[model samples]
Target: MTANPLDDPFYYLNNFQRVLAWLSQRYADVLSSEEQRFIEDFSALPRGSQGLLVRMVMRKGLRFRHGKLNYGEIGDIGSAVAPLLALGWVDEQAPLGLVELFEVLLKAEILSCLGHLIEQPKARKTEWLQALEGHFSQPQTFRDWCPQLEDRLYSLTVMPLCDRLRLLFFGNLYQDWSEFVLADLGIFTYETVEFSAESRGLRSRQDVDACLFLHDCQQRFEAGEALEEVVAQVNGLTLDNPWLERRRGKLLFQIGQHGERIGDFALALCIYRDCTYPGARLRMIRVLERIGEYALALELGETAAQAPQNAAEAQALFRIVPRLRRKLGGPPVPRSLAREVERLDLHLPRIDPTLSVEYHVQAHLHDDAAPVHYVENSLINSLFGLLCWPAIFAPLPGAFFHPFQRGPVDLLNEDFHERRAELFAACFAELDDGRYRQTILRRYAEKWGVQSPFVFWGALSGELLEQALDCLPPEHLRHWFLRLLLDIKANRAGMPDLIQFWPQRKAYRMIEVKGPGDRLQDNQLRWLEFCHEHQMPVAVCYVQWAEQGA
Candidate 1:
């Protein structure tokens, strides 16, 4: 007897084919006649040619150069291009003009540095290109202009969004839903340093392909497509790549999610077992509980609670498992179970004194007229922002220059720590000479006066700025600099809340205020620890509700 289709290894690919068929039918209204015909033609093409067409459509430029096609899975670049060329989807010898050059540069994020040149009135495209070519020809000029040109060229946006969506969703069938869901699940893996250069390119390409397939399957399942219909399409479909094996768990997790969405709790639970995906176990227990399988749920929950990978997972399982056991009319949790679960509550609300002590202390001092202060996270961080101005707003050489990116792309680089001493030395030199103050004021007046990605900039008031400058310590500033360099994403949040200024003493205190039932999170603890180590004048003020007569 043949193995069940559900147990087949190529089940995923089969499901993908069904989804493609479904998309072709569902998107008939929105897709152009040519697009529909293209889809039909695409289905008829050999799998290799089909994959090549997907890549060509997804590739960066309107025209594909013969030489560039030598890389990646596309065999005999000419053969691949022939079909696409015949279809008129890809042009081999497109003319490059001034407007096209500007658009290409803009997409490449190189336009910002040369924006002034391009924005010149009455400058033709030919003139601009000629000027740009001249600049490129002079080695000294190119070096002085952009040291990172090579890196920038590698990072240019290849496919336009509309084109990507047309290929990805096959014309509005699923739209951006696949990208959203995949991103949410952490499937895209934007951090590229982990993979080899060649693997990085391959993985990125596969990510697009996988997202298209997953999106189709998800849409089909949600649209009430039958399981048999999906399984039948999978009968002979296969993907022979290491990427498929690597993504098997994620694919299974997605299948489980689809199952759950369609109210197939048992199917979801079974798929979750095969998923090996992070958070799958937790999801399985939830599914089991939902389906009235109390005994199995309790058993899995008890086991998971004891050996969870992290404190958060342990805490989550501990919180829910006990409740599950109780609902099942089971005996009270054993002593050993209780002991293991007890550590999970170490950082719980009852033990945290932040809320009670911090908020009340700050509240009582509000009546004192001598020391003027405001509860703000913006003030000090904004001062740090002034120090970061050159690196933050400086038009980077080849960085993906979007209007939204208000900081250096390299700010998140792992090697940024190596440049910390040099960067901060310059910042401190400006601070000591009072140049930073001028720059800060100038920046505030010019660019930052409107809006910025840094939350502190928008909330910075003149009074607060004055207080920050007066109270700022070189050591505390250095600590913040180090913290920001260490990890910009992690360090920016959880700063001290209330900053109180003593104008007479030329001093200020960084106060972390917590209301009743509030606690310091991990990031806040890290900041507080840094302050303590640096001997910075930082305090935690916890509020007592009863003392305040609330």
Candidate 2:
């Protein structure tokens, strides 16, 4: 197949107006004249959206075997144009009516690139990093390629860090920066230690080898080398990038540790206070406590404890409060009160360390199948369920484990696949009118080893449970598992110490699923009671099908 001239991606984007005119004609029969017109007048869109749109078109061309775009290929084509609309590239009154088509193009490009990032990290790393360097480099080259980008793109955007980390770490530009760019790339600075005759030139490879030199300095420092000599040789560049500010706290904590090693307690405290990361803030508090600065530690630890996931740190801070009292000879801790004085080594047990909320959710979804022996093997049922989905249906945010079946956005309104599956299951069950209805219910309860007798369940209760199970189809079970897996993701799930629910009850739940032999602990019982007292029905179950282990 002859290449689509549109596929030729190049800089000098505005310079291609004449070429666009001819190519629009060449592919005129393939695309409607309206789309051709959009292509011709592409420069009218906002700069960002225009870049997004052409990139979209270039991707669309790749899916075509012989220069023919199918409905599936073009369904999201409008999204590409959307960036332009979003950026105010084109006015609402503009002549171009194919904005929707442009969106589809954008979606295609996004999906294709994301798919590559997920499936082929090593293969895509060089290109991905190069693209990033090119976008974000001065004059707009690749996108931002810093450690902070990890926090934004993967952590905040909810992209898979596991899949993209290799690319971010080992990309060509990353190697260039980490291995050769050094201080120029903005990571570290260095001093000339024993200036070698071999290292003479300005652009010598050694000048770029900042990381290696930093490692050597650290080794020398550890060996108790003269600090004055090393300090004199090291010129201070001290990175000022705003992005570096994010890691400044970590660096401060490290500096504090170094100060402590050198018996500079005041300097250590100063470095610790300069840290903004909460973990470092808590560490500072701990350091103060260790040094008999109880009052200062209490003040700092109290402040750090207000943030989420700081309970562990708070416990650490609280333990020191009494010790400080004793150190000052204020009063002896009472025998009963002594128990409340937490041991420094025996920290508050992390709530459910082995099983995370996501794992808890997946196990709940598996219901009867969660294993008793270990956390990892407990996911057998959910794993099987996940394995059932089409490979292409690999876990996607918000779509995994959802009750509804997926289709193109265009077909979603009319698709009844989920409803059809539920209705089909109903067809196989004994109806309420049948004499066997009670018998079936009884048998089901007994088979699952339920202690309660099967009764005439309320319509609402039956319907809710039916709908929940029906949502999990055998064909797309993997997607469901993917949803659960995502829900447990460290970044996505956060800490599940407490389950929060919205008024509408979307994106959160408080259901408790149990196996036949399982029993609620005291804390679990109290939680259930608390939830019940609040009038929210926390779903609880002893599923039978998961009997032998999911």
For lDDT, the strongest prediction is 1
Among all windows of 10 consecutive residues in model 1, the one with the lowest summed lDDT is 339-348
Error of 2 at 60 (Å): 42
TM-score of 1: 0.40
| Candidate 2 Cα errors over 4 Å, as ranges | 1-242, 258-264, 302-309, 330-370, 376-550
lDDT per residue (tens digit) for residues 348-409 in model 1: 13333554443445445653433445545566567666666555544434222122233444
Per-residue lDDT of model 2, residues 1-550, tens digit only: 8553334343323323433543343323333344445564565655544554433332422111112222332244345445544544322222211222122223334334343433434444444444444333232101221212211110011012211221212211122112212333333322212222221111222322332344355567568775544433332424332222333343445556777777777766765665554456666666787788877765665565565333334445456555666776669665323112111121122235575433444433442222111122122222222222222132322122111122111111112224233432342232223323333334334422211111112211332322323332322323323223322212112111222233232223344545335554434443344444444334444433322322
Q: Which 10-residue window in model 2 sums to the lowest lDDT? A: 150-159
